[model samples]
Target: MTRKTVRIAMNGVTGRMGHHQHLVRSILAIRRQGGLDLGDGTVLWPEPVLVGRRAHALDALARQYDLEHRSTDLDTVLADPAVEIYFDAQVTSAREEALRKAIAAGKHVYTEKPTATGLAGALELARLAQEKGIRHGVVQDKLFLPGLLKLKRLVDGGFFGRILSVRGEFGYWVFEGDWQPAQRPSWNYRAEDGGGIVVDMFPHWEYVLHELIGRVRSVQALATTHVPQRWDERGKPYAVTADDAAYGIFELEGGAIAQINSSWAVRVGRDELVEFQVDGTEGSAVAGLRGCRVQHRSATPKPVWNPDLPATEAFREQWQEVPDNTEFDNGFKAQWELFLRHVYADAPYHWDLLAGARGVQLAELGLRSSAEGRRIDVPEIAL
Candidate 1:
């Protein structure tokens, strides 16, 4: 079996996600002993061409990675005969145009979430990719989380029989870029640039809930701009045009219900981040990004609250850290490898543009729900 040396053109390589997702991950995979081995004796490795607007940064990145191909122009790389895939990690607003151009140039497309800022653009991108017969994929990293995988196993094994409800606690205080450099980009704070909790995260929840439990039938949500003004990287004040916090209730296809609280204002004081607890008739499971705890009917413990009762930390005592079963890779990098395996081995990959489009739909609908002050029925987009 011959290993495919995939020639990849990485646009937005200088951006945070671009660097981590495309450049660094690709290089790391190449340096690995077996070159990102997929199952069935197939190995996938990438030949990355760093593409960005700034020449100096591209040159510096090329030097850092020992990559010979670096480019400031996107079209030239798209026209190159060697490039097999176009990887886009640019801002949401620029995603559609760039992907459309890449598809027109006969390149397979893989990009970050939301696919586009709105449902229409996302659908159009999906349609265009289909028309061009190009492989299209969107990032869906949460589905691959260790804790989520554990929770999934519990659910699959019927540990949570007749599930009742789910509660998701996801957030951390994001520092203002003025005083402290932000982990995420500044554009995420501006609505005009396709920034908002609803748009940015709902897609993740959408897939998590749908694939893990059930499909979301409806949603009622509230959004808030907790930080109206924030400082940019230059210490200049900028108006926050997007919501930094969101509280949402999702009614799943079955009787199961879910409450999702996503915010950027909360302080970190909990277990492994982005925690979730699910209740069922037979058992209950609480999980975080790194661990999980299950309490069956036999293991259920009753407690009484008292001033001197100490903390009723059931999860802390009962939970076990989920072993890191999968091989080492960053979240974005793992997803990228999955995409490559899907492309080369014809393996099933769930992170397609339609899934990405569904995320945008959820975000757009959440906004409508907030504006209308009512529950919104999530309409299905063509897959």
Candidate 2:
């Protein structure tokens, strides 16, 4: 009947993900977003208060967004009766403490992925959120990507009957943050800050695999640090404690096998950015970031690879770009609207902390597997 204005206090609003996901994506740029079908017919937009350690920085953001409130005090912001939702985009190591305080302060929480530095903290967060009876959610933005959504459609349509395998190729050469002024934080290469491809990305693939194909029952991985030394902004050499790349094998519940190769070392060779190719008995589909190509059983037989072959002489004539029909926003903002509706309209949003914990479980398992040189069985969390 009436519009409910949700006030959000953004923790770590000045940092990388915080600046984008909190300021640019959620608040300042949310009006242009679409795809949230809240049937009750109510207008919902998040009113945000930028919370950071520096007043001047937050004040600049407040001015840019035309927002009136900027606070250096996290406790004050959490305790404010006017703020209904607490959003945390802080680093993974800092998340649990802030989230716990938000729950104690009586505000619902929506946060970025890898909910905690370790699985124990993640489990505790989930337990406390349930005990407090608050609406809690985690960012599973990849599930909302148009390309990934199309893959979801294919799965729902049963195009790939009795799926056999899934192979994901994901990565690009990240800039050397020193001379190039690295795109990510300095701590991303440091082990103490919960930085690594295994921790940062496994949760994403866990949800992607579970949502589209099947749940991950077991995982075995080998992590490597390709470029072990890097320089910071000032030319000081820093030893990289995190993995620059990871090769993982997942055994799904339905006899499906999935392998994910995530790296920062690969050069972009194909037209697509990230690709997930699924093979089946009747047909197969290869999904990229923007398009997909399908090969039915009626298509010509596959050709063999040859070293002494030109581009056109090889397998070049069979691929086609997937038709893009639905107008999709950038993946980040799409999930933002869904989260708003999940809070306002009481809509069922699957990307919650429980889902995040599933990934944390996978990462923990992968680390254990890497350490023990054995396959680790994924343990189910009691949601």
Candidate 3:
């Protein structure tokens, strides 16, 4: 058995998603587990070089992980012949330029979703990557979630016959920095910094619906800034220029409707922070991040309609909980392993830059639909 080391230049390792998900959970976890076995007697080892602007932060991360490679100079790292892959989790505005440089340097690239802030920019990056013959991918981690996986299994098993609709509720209150510090970054509330709920979330829904149900055909959205002002990280008040909430209705390829509500202003009243309820002719399922509950048509209870009568039946108890029969890894780590295999073992990977461009396209159209107060058709992007 041969052991191979693949050096990955990881940018934006200081950010929350980049540090927590990609660095610690995904790459380091893989290294800790003795790398990924390719099933052909060969194992792929990922050696990550942390790249970020702050040397202090990078050094701290390296010390925390007991890693040796840490670099503040991206150009020097990108030019290194030892670096095989360049992964970006930077801010949306800075992603395109960095990715362009990576592709030009002939490095295989993987990045977080909404690859760019605009559809044209995203498409151009995909085209340029193809022209340079560099393998590229974007994060679509939600598709690998345990709850969604169960939902997918039910769909594959025909448990939900003729899917009717999907309703998704995502989000919880993000505190203003006045009293309790905000959970999310302050940049998320400023539109000037490439921040908005539509751009942040529509890409997720685009792939989720496309994978679990059907491709989205059209969208009607209403975006609003529910919180006009919020305190920044420095405890200074700032006007929230970006939309804090978005209500979207999407038409799927097979005429299935999907309505999702995403908001930073909302409080949690559901079973989880995020949940999707899918109803069909034969069954219904409500899936959260880690749990899924289902109600088959045969097990559905009948109740007499009486507005005056007190509700006695336990509606929630009627549904059956789906068992966790198999162990589930972190979704981000799962996708990272797949990408590594795709790069080294020549495994088939479909979540490419083209797919990423489609996500950006959905976000672009969703914003337009909301601004125009009408349904906007989603056009296919030709790669």
- Model 3: per-residue lDDT, tens digit, 91-171? 887888999999999999999978998999999999999999888899999988899999998999999999999999999
Better structure of 2 and 3 per TM-score:
3
How well is each residue in 1-383 modelled by candidate 2, as lDDT tens digits? 44556789988888877887657865667654532346676666667888888898888888777888879899989878999989888888888899989988878889998898888888888888888988899988888777788888888998888999999989887777666766567677777888888998899999999999999999999887887887776768899998878889999989999999988767877667688999988778888777788877777466677778754433435755567778977677777777787777787887777887888889888877887889888967875
The lDDT for every candidate, in the order shown, is: 0.83, 0.82, 0.93
Greater lDDT among 1 and 2 belongs to: 1
Q: Give the TM-score of candidate 3.
A: 0.98
Q: Where is model 1 more than 4 Å wrong at Cα?
A: 1-3, 36-43, 305-315, 318-329
lDDT of 1 by residue, 97-214 (tens): 8888999999988888878888988888888888888888988878776778888988998888898999998999998777787777788999999899888989888989988898
Candidate 3 local accuracy as lDDT?
A: 0.93
Indicate the worst ten consecutive residues by lDDT in candidate 1.
319-328
lDDT of 1: 0.83
* Model 2, position 96: C-alpha lDDT score: 86
Model 1: colliding residue pairs: none
Candidate with the larger TM-score of 1 and 3 = 3
Which ten residues in a row are the worst by lDDT in model 2?
30-39
Stretches of model 2 off by over 4 angstroms after superposition: 32-41, 304-316
Number of backbone-clashing residue pairs for each candidate, in the order shown: 0, 1, 0
